[model samples]
Target: MTHLDDTESDDIGTLLGADGPFARELPNFAPRLAQQAMARAVQQAIAGRDTLIAEAGTGTGKTFAYLVPALLSGERVIISTGTKTLQDQLYFRDLPKVRSVLGARLKTALLKGRANYLCLYRLDQTVREGATFERTQAAQLATIRAWSARTRRGDRMELAEVPEESPLWPRVTSTPENCLGVECPFFEDCHVVKARREALEADVVVVNHHLLFADLALKQEGFGEILPGAAAFILDEAHQIPELAGQFFSQSISARQLTDMAKDVLTECTGITGAIGLLLEPVEALQDALRKLRLALEPLPTRGAFQLLEDRADVRASLHELRELLATLEELLASQAERSRGFANLRERAELFTERLERIVESHGDQDVRWYETFPRGFALYATPLDLAVPMRGLRERTHAAWIHTSATLSVAGNFDHFARQLGLDDPRTLSLGSPFDYARQGLCYLPPDLPDPNARDYTEQVIESVLPVLHASNGRAFLLFTSHRALRRAAELLQDKVPWPLFVQGTAPRPRLLEEFRASGHGVLLGAASFWEGVDVVGEALSVVVIDKLPFAAPDDPVLMARLAALEQSGINPFMGWQVPSAVIALKQGAGRLIRDVHDRGVLVLCDPRLTSKGYGRLFLASLPPMPRTRALADVQVFFANALSPDARDGGEGRAGV
Candidate 1:
């Protein structure tokens, strides 16, 4: 095997294109110009050590496009993905395949957020306390205990019997907040520390956006920094970076935080045997304060930003009481600093949490927005940045490396201005690689006319009515995607008795299982929210009709979005054009890209929102889509699917006969 020199890097075409090793190494490899082009661009970025943002359309083999270049560059690189699912795929499948193809001796490590790993300290504490559990959870914990005795990685994903959303997970895992760090008796055997050690020393590391932010924000637990040492960075699914970075930069404190801290202090006192008796009094007082705060805010609406919640007499009083109690707790914990190291760490965390809550409640940052997210159990107060550019600019300056942000949906109307501006990257070398799918021959963009505006009260019902016929034509191999829970529930209610196929909703099961069941059901109609729009791939005839209830827009009432929009308005910016439209366009592109996933696949994309046709901004959404044949008539959509469901599509024969 020969090491490719700088001159040989130009042969990226031969490597990715047909008649190259890809053809011989991969049985089903179909070369696309977009993939080859993107790979070369990535190679160039690494060679020059400059920032680049590339949008490779679907079927571009983007994982290889970036992975191949990064691996070949022989640089200490970190590739971050949007989700853990993709993270695993890159580590376990794509990276290995590409490395094998390159004959590269790459040292790779996969690191997830700390929450994914089991904390032996937490697990032992729970087990020793004889914590009560439901029968199923008890059995699950028993299985975990049995596995814990032998497992090396200690990743919760190894427990295939336990679902990812199981309530038992949080009990076993450690969050950054509750983590005892080096104070734990099991510190030497900690899995998170082990994983981070591997990532810190490896040639290539695969991480998720959350972990990347931890590195970029310099808040990672368990070890040394990961960002400054890496020679290059590649972010797959880069569209998720802005929102994820926003979360990391923001500060939040919640009733749950207080409860967790109190519980941890008490558990420490109880679990550590004859140590730290003085901490319990303040811990108990802290618990009482938390309860008082919860009771005070119980009467108010479940959620609102500080603007709405701060003025209420009961909430204000509760805030004052909680702040005073937290202060007292901090002082007490500080006094115990000399007695126990754990107490010292607790005091520092308490101080941080207290400071964070004050900042959130007071709206401390100049460009920050104060908001709240409500829940049935409790609510959280947040101080979120209105824009991530300032913080992102700081990260860019701190790290001198080639930063590549690549995704299939990073651009709107063939432009990267929205994404670049959000991330404070001015004049990055940008490229847009078109999809290889012949959308003109394989797909149809169905826009039904005379539908009500998406905001109207009758919108969900109208959408259901409009798509019922399309479902019939395709024999119910459809994905019904909604933008809101209210809309999803309404559509599910109306279509319950009408649709012939089995109906599947998002929350009914784990995401992977739902997709699996939907696929196995063959004609199942799965209705879901934003999660359903992206990261879903259903090839062949199982998914032939994609029905979008409305133009994909973030909720206007959402705390973060609302605050950002207001901030933009204050700055004399057109919030709608500058922020809202581009966001919606990117989301709509994700929803639309769900169809026609494979070369031979065929489907009809149903846009149920009338605003998509009536409003002027709709043109931007259309321009972002793969240029498929458009139709305004319902009969045309029905006919398109009718012809698609024929033997033509399955036989790999000519399609687009009806359209």
Candidate 2:
């Protein structure tokens, strides 16, 4: 691999400058100083084989900042994004544009987890059991079958006709436990295999954090890793890495996995004579035990530590029965393993589940928190690690590649220590670049006066009442971002008839469709919870007001959080300030970032919680926000919007107030 020398690193600025090839070749291209600085930092990191934690503010064009260096570095690069949507965008849109503008001839491949690709073996199994499906599902299966023939990539993203939540997907897709790998008849033509093969030979591979961490955790041992050895690794939206690392490292077993295994066993029995008669009763008994366990857990809270199960006699009995049933099913499947490949896979799955259940139930180690969360019709058990730093650092050291972590909200109160600690980076090189959007001129932060505590029973109602004037001032082009779904629903109900704009609530429609209609409505008020806080972009005047119901904090009742806080306390750390506050600050930043996406974008941010001024620690949250002018009076908000809409407003006529 060729490294960028000092002279070549210096040229990165000129390459991304106003007179560069990008400006000449790409339309609407504007050179940004912050982006240039970030590109230089990334180039230096890559050339020196160092770890860099970069916090690029919104509008910094962080994608291009890292891309130009990665493309020019002449090294195999792996770019991991926070979501599959961003992964696709980076591969299909951003990478192509940057490569074309730079004239860099390099190969790039898009690789997702096996769940995203269609499995020929599973498709055949589903086809054999077509009559067992409902009419709607059967039709959906037919559509997928038709698509499977012509779709070269077999990526589910290419087929938007079928809803992502359709039950038909799991039937046609393969999981790690069920995949036959090289033993399958369709091994030569397997979509996941073909994609991984292409990725191995490509100069760059685009993947999401789940797949990246899955690889680091060695969760794909059946098929091996898809990410190739790289000279440099760039993780976009790096703030998500800490939490995602914990999830990937955790041991988990879901009721859905057990049910799926049972279904697969039934499907496998279809081809072998007398197999159904022998295995059907064990599968049914396992499913009945699972249902009983879920029912026994209904009286407790939705989520808590494993100790909760020990206190309830009925729950304990149900769990014991479930474990016994799983063991029995494993024994039965072992008898049928020699029948076929499908039976062999089923037996392995049953054994894995049995072992996982026993481990989770028996684990009492302080390093890992054993917990369970019950869903509407299912439940999942997890034994998550108390800290991710050691394992994450281990992975980094094993790679022996330069690591670049960049995100819009990585630092809190201008400090990257919290993020660095989470990923176990000790005294790492860091860069913090402010956005060039001129937030003081383009945006105003409005902290509504005299709101009750966030925990008040009628707090949601008061929040709506406080923001009603701001919503009216902005003419209903706003996003009501809540920390919890309960508040979001309450606010939605309160404003249903009060405001005249088209109300787009989160649960009413798919997120993409809601965003599409919201953008087109011109005066839509969209209300959403956690998922809407980040990864949402609405530029221009279409979204002018962003109302946050409360300071974005993790719920104290969360099982994992409780365990982590306890662990931190034992280590002589103030968990509230050291952990909770910093985490909330990053989350609040992500929510506030939804405003002023572009330089010309103008908006008012209404913070409904009085804690910003009432609490001593609130300063940390306020300090982390962009340098927007702050205001307390609703009249200033009204005037700002009024002036923003006036014909002469382009020259900074909006009102400004100090924090």
Candidate 3:
């Protein structure tokens, strides 16, 4: 066992006081297994020679477990979360409570991406440009203007009622691509800069994974360090890190950004005379040509693999034409005109695009990665991911203090190979803590007998039929987890009339509101995909059944997924074992975890996927879950739910019996 050093012991001893901000006595609260795990993590972090991968189970009070060690150690720590919601939770709620309780008046700050903070220069520019605003947007701007006058923090979350998707958000926000940085007239008043300055001074900093990865990508280039060289770094929700890192490591130039750059330039250069316009005409012509090329590619069938510019000669010819156009644009930019900014921006875009295109053309059939992605609305584009493992390694190295990475399902059974390999870490100190809940006594994993294949057309109907009786037995308290949104919608429609519970679809009332209603209504059944998996905490009888429609496989047709699979195959790895199976196992563990959140929580889990029963690979997935009582009979599930939903049920009172 690792002993707390003098500094750690002193900090903890001081905090366990009668007059401290702690609402409860620390010793009275039973010590948790997570505390031991966290203690070891702190030791490892202080040593700064090894990495740690810890899978602290639910009910571990995992947040406070790591926070205590981090605070007591007195190190500059950076905490990166998977979602903005968690970031807000940590910054606004968790940190303050911990500080007050611990009697540690340590400075702390919350920093988010530039997009989350209002860019005063951009806001002023948008208002001055007389940009047309929709009625709702105009009202939002008026509200923001009023709030901006009184607000001190300038954090967007301070605004009481801002919708996440408000058009006003982007109008007031800035991106790295569009930001003029220190050169801006409003640089001193910049919210992003102010937040960063606060973070630099703070002992602890909270940020989301996206911003953390962005800073890593930009670190050598000297933009800004979101996750600075900290004494300790704790990455909560570490499961999502790989995919997010993939995005950060990839190069993407969006159409919207390109168009925005052009518009900004046009606005900046509007009052310039004729010679500049004539010279800049070629820049516009080149943009139009590139736009037409993208338009042509849009209608093609959605297929795997990046589309390289066919024929090196054709690509070279286009490059020559673009070069000539940019040369003219440079000449216009050199002229002392009001539109110089526009010309300069055009020139920048040309140079950037040419470089990206050259890389794409040269990377075909090479180890260098290239791929295409299309939006739901049908706009298609290309990307090239830089070496991912490098930034991942960089993050692990920079976080100097204790780093504890936890998730509900960080391993496949007991092996951490899949998750470890993805994070580019090899067998760092690893631990897997089992859930305190006794799944063998309280819950049952039910797989219906003789079900049709999950990929068949009639699978949705079969799944709904299989779970309706259990839903009826439990009187609603169920979540129908689907592999896809389409399946979720279909099952929701079919089960609407058949089940006794009032159904809540995922998108109907927003996630938090729907969950609130589910708890309030009591007889509530929710059907959702993806987001329904984890971070859902419904204890007691309110959630007594979890019906997973099928194995949650990453969509095979997703262009990025396909590309990754191809790359894996070329490396002589089984895509299923190395990629697809592990991903599904993690997701399934998330869904299954929702059922038995607390000790008193008892539920029936119905996995409708036949593959779990028929294939040898299924054992790996099963071993990843809680040690639940397994059942194949629908009758057994009905009985289990009946007992779970009853008020008189007594096996797991106060949520500790399951343990």
Candidate 4:
């Protein structure tokens, strides 16, 4: 119901112009045509209540592009990002700067999922059972209790003393199934309730994709309809939506859910007489069944269709036993449901798990794929729909709000059809704004010649050999992104004592710590896998080269991917060209984007996959990237780096071929 006046519409362009408020207030701000154009398009989309698909390349200042229009729109806005880290960045860093520069009067709030908040009721329960925890965990619990008395927001991120992966987190946090809602003794002062209440009243709310999709999928995360009634929904890093939508729509059951239910039942028994004797046998039986099933699945592939269970008689037997034991636990809990609210919740969880297991086991429809994935000591089963377009479109229509999807890599070969079809949009408003950064002058694309095929047995070794020269030329300030962990590990082993610069390897430390140390190590070579492909920003001379080991195609053995490809083929679509290629192209765009983050950033991108040259589809990948000059010879790369670091080069002199 909010509309922009003529002056306000003009102000979007003027405010983001060279003499805008940002240019005056911020020291590093520079105006770009692409950013202004994107702002106008977003403004129009919000005013007209239309869907807009925007692809703003890196350095386009897409965040500001959307934020300016959103803040100026004079309506309730919800901005959902790709990750929690980004959600924090927007809420803590970006929003404040823009709000200050514009002097906007809108109220804003940061809302995360229930797991991010501390559950006071659950914390009290854990305190009562402190004797059962290890010495370190008990100490961690004491720390959390002390912090709980003084922390205002109660966000777990506020407590850096406790590591994120600490087991104590689950003991203190409440999931939707365990939360008693208004029935809890601490409902009046609950943090999740307070956060949601603030979001309901704020003019703008910042959330991650998981919370946004959880609302759309109607998944119970303690609160209800936290995102509804917003006039605009701006999805940043929108390229991650299609795949994430599938995850939200899927019906899943996991070993952790079952184990947690058993643990909760035992915790509940502490308050009720005779409850322990009644539930002890069934709880132990269910735990044993879960362990047996995991052991049975250990012999199969880590992930595959549910049909894999049919071929293994032992696995089938174990699954059947697990299901039966779950039913017994549910029935026993039902008898004690009348005793307490906690018992009633436990009964419902047991019943839900039993029904989910039955549905997953019985699912044989062609429209959905029933798949199972195994971890080191756990497993999860899912029945995921083949297409998310119908449900996603339905959700959008129901919202009756403007939808703006923007990211750096939403298009393939200058086309948006692949991304649009995934989201079920039909010729929606489209805008493609290239990055204002001078890619041609600031970067070089080096496809190393004489490299073996990516599928060859010695491909990893060859890739390490090929990138060593590039590393030497750049002084090893590089990120070597691989398609899989096996290759990353191999590269790390090969580069260990062979290079003069320090090496940073994934899995050795937390992602944030690794990035921090890598940035400090001026000449460090970091080896990483999928997680490093996107949402990573490293600007300046610290990161000068990015070497991709292979084309980032989804593994063919993935159960959901295999099913989706088959469905596409049945619909007369070229699964390889239409689905796989476009997906890989978007992924490659993200990988290549790391090389040039700022206007002054100059680096070489080395793609070690020979398939990019040997195959016809290579053209699509090449055309989608930034317009960096391409080279096939190693000498060009050497010269590009040598001249790039020279003082003369810094003073506008050039020795590189493309330059």
Candidate 5:
């Protein structure tokens, strides 16, 4: 726990009240009672050292509500966000404004995942070896080189002109298995180490959930972690914690990882050192084995558990052969004439890979779920734990700090039990605030009728047809969020030439760029998948409608989901009724939340899935949404838009026809 001064100062209400610091500091500030109330509750939670789960609705000024108390509390704090975008916003925008207004000497630092920082050693290695890149990437690498000379933080985001999916990024950045740590030649000038030092000295440290979980994993393993001295913990966008925690708790080893390690070792042998003659044949053999292993995996399904994969004779044989080769390579590296750092790194990686594969093959317990997932490049075998409650509890015990978990959609139908159970929070006080926006006047829920089931082959086409009238009424400032990538692509193709507005697809550019294009175009239809469902905000005129093609539901056949359901069934629970329905309801709530981002913002919510109305569980979805005007007719949607956008309408510029 942080040392407490115990000097009470201005109350949360006074700081956030009308004519308070905000009203005095910012000209556009509006007083929101719900925001003020949430701020007070957060302060109380922090002061009392209690656990709190809060759901502050859209337009609640939730960021300020939490940040104000956090800054004034005088405790060393670690604020974790769900995404990098939000992390940047807090570090760059929100925190500064609050500090200036309060005149508090609050020092803040921003830290990201390891990959976000450049590895001076890796970049030097690439340059020393004269590695070749594709033409476009070569140009980008030149730019990176120019920037590296001037970059103070060595953060990739500093290269704003570089595309997010640039192929050169992975080559320059370091991963856990590849990083040489303190043994690196460039240790003193390490960007990651320097960032950690700065973070530890600051009053507030900002990080994303991935890095935070990495810290937690290290703590669990009794290793050094990155977070500064922290007492209170604030998790914004708390709904994402469950899925992310599942990933961090799992152990994964991919064929591509092995292949990359082999290439790195070979490069070290041939480029940096003069061990090419001794290692060339064995390295080639390892590379061939890895390639054959990738080929063997190509026959399996895109994703499934190792149990299902074991039926493939080719894959099993390849895995066995790869294991044998890894063992032999480890022995061969062990016998190297000079025990160089490169040789030591390769041997360690080889041993770790062998251990992970052995675990994937032999690991079996009610506690762990082993699976394999195939991507465009390669397949990864995972041994993810089915249960996280025990680990979560351990984290809480270790931190010994107040925990405040807050998000816009943490509950389903006013119930936080699902989230609480997943997080293993013990009877935490819960708060659920409806959006301060007048939903009755600011939004309309449109459920189109006579649409085919979501599983139907032509449902994407039907969804297009159903929302055409609304898009026409609103002039195409909308987000068409799909549950699947295939559906999103299909919808994009069907609407390519039909809609009068410019169309933007998710994969055309980075998500931030697509959103910028959407906002800058003034009116465009953005087609996206699950990634667009949450943490996206477009206020006023640029976003007027959110179209969800179907209820967001995880595939039951997913290996992890299957294992979870099996675990629940063993405990005499119905997976769908108890867990699946509530989870979908929470997701549907997040989609609905994309509409009405502010007090006066008016928009329409279009859900094309007939199950939202046809199924018995549909009521659960409806109950989870804000209290608003609900209609099934396209005519009502058209009417709402026409009235909202009409120049004569009273609310025309009062944040109508927008988010």
Candidate 6:
């Protein structure tokens, strides 16, 4: 048996030497600050005493840093991430290399959420239902079905070119609402179960924030936990945890549930014998009541939990009406010609909706925090908080393990308190690792001295004017990140006709396609919203300038932000300092992070929001960026760009100190 203990005293540098497997396996690999962080992190994990929040800067080689320690510690570890791309990256690319180099002494597993795995039973049901499948999707389904026959690894990411919103995806995936679990026909061969079993057996389990938060929520109700008793729980991309945790912590039921019930009634209205319409009478009544509920809530903010009908009389009356009607429908369907045929679907849907509504009504009031969601040209719902902090704290307390939460933008102005307070972590060991890149020589921070206030009319026009020059200097190898989609659209309109380069906007093509076109078309200037702020990798000269329209503060009118800030204010906290500013700081960092992804990458981060140089709060945003050459003068920016592209760009004459 492989001994489960601390790694033998060995220099990590030696392990990373020229003759070592790491050298042979990864050509561009070398010792990183992350390696040292990992050694300390591993020792802390073993000690099991305190939480560690270590910031491994961009290109600090953080993934391998944590992975090496997690592997060498010889204990069960669960690594969670914010994105599926990184999750798959760790599982498929990084994990294998680590195992091979370490002589395969450790076992690891990649576990995705249920939605990513195909539910054989559901797939079969969908096929039986004769749902006319799209041609390409049908082909992909056939491929997945064939591959499912012999494959042991059940990751959906293995299937290439499967767009996230493919219609076939929903038909094949599982949700807790529809999952029959062990009672399903294909339960024995369930991909989710198989993956979970592997996870339970492995020394390390890789998961994303959604899955981890789900497991935490599940444990509250005595549902199964995903990660076993592990020595450490390392949450990467920890910046995203709070928002996701808020979601898992909240409860929601949508008007769509009632709509689906009405559709079910319609489906069962025909082809059945006795009293089909009568049986569906209560369902129809329930649908009408739900419509009334939606109308009653029409006056409220489009999103957030609010009590539209105070005193529970209207809602209780509706529930009573629904319950009585459902009973009649059940009795009518019981006497139908085909007893079980054509009846089960509607019955199941009705029963589920009723149960969810009952839960909502029963849990309403201040005891359970309540809210309503309004979507623009989309579905809306009413929701309540399902105790977010409890589960999160449970995960923290039970693990009794040294947990490390790291991100490039974790702290705002050298203070980790904002995220720490939200996550219920107190004074965790923290460090701010400056980016290792030579930012002074490679990058410029351009804050336009004169611009209209970000909130004023013609703000976007001014932003475009300020940034268009930088784009010209770089010949349009730029990413323009806007605070809102409306502004993005406005800026795109302003630049489309005037700019002397190919401009790609976010919604014009899908995000990946836009990024592709931007990278390929050398005159690349891509304008995008939130998705473009972070996780966009455009190394080298292909992305030479990132123009941010403004400091990316959460919209004051956003329901969640308003609600959260209100809650903070009620508790006697400065909402701006406690919530808004820190959030914006993190977001600004994400936008600025796009500027220099590699050592060879040289660029300017031009903020059209003069707040970075004008406002007192600007210092917070400024301090959060890489230690780069800052500039405000138009002349300085022009000179810097000229020097950057000149033959002597690398020779580095001190262009301008602080602009």
What TM-score, over all chains together, does every model reach? 0.94, 0.96, 0.87, 0.97, 0.95, 0.87
lDDT of 1: 0.83
Q: Find the 10 residues in a row with the least total lDDT in model 4.
A: 650-659
**Which is better, 5 or 6, measured by lDDT?**
5
What pairs collide in candidate 6? 302-374, 303-374, 304-372, 305-371, 305-372, 306-371, 306-372, 631-659, 632-659
Ranking under lDDT, best-scoring first?
A: 4, 2, 5, 1, 6, 3
Q: What is the number of residue pairs that collide in model 3?
A: 8
Expressed as tens digits, the lDDT of each residue in 131-200 for candidate 6 is: 5667897787788788667666656766766777776776678766556656567889888888888888
Better of 2 and 3 by lDDT: 2
lDDT of 4 at 217: 81
Clashes of 6: 9
Per-residue lDDT value at 540 in model 6 = 69
Give Cα-based local distance difference scores for all models: 0.83, 0.89, 0.71, 0.90, 0.83, 0.72
**Per-residue accuracy of model 1 over 1-659 as CA lDDT, tens digit each:** 12347656668877987888888898788888889888988888887778899998888889989988888888899999988888888899888889888899988999988889988987887788898888999998999899899999998878899888888788889877677787878999999989988887899999888888876774755444755678789999999888889888878888887888777667656545444566777777777776777777776666666777777887788788788888888887777666655667777879988898777777656688787776777668887788889999888778778899999999989999999999999789999998898888888888877787677888888888778888888889899999998899888899899977999998888789999999999899999998888988888778888988888777766777877887889999999999999999999889888888888788899888777767799889888989999998878776776665456555564533434
lDDT of 5 by residue, 223-253 (tens): 2454535768899999999898998888888
Once model 3 is optimally superposed onto the true structure by TM-score, how far is the C-alpha of residue 531 displaced, in angstroms?
A: 2.7
Give the C-alpha miss distance for residue 497 in model 1, angstroms: 0.8
Model 3 clashing residue pairs (backbone)? 231-400, 231-401, 232-401, 265-342, 269-339, 438-658, 599-655, 600-655
Backbone atom clashes (below 3 Å) for every candidate: 0, 0, 8, 0, 0, 9
- For candidate 1, the TM-score is 0.94
Expressed as tens digits, the lDDT of each residue in 412-481 for candidate 4 is: 9889999999989977888999988888889999999898878799999988888888988888899999
Between candidates 3 and 6, the one scoring higher on TM-score is 3
- Name model 4 segments beyond 4 Å from true: 1-9, 646-659
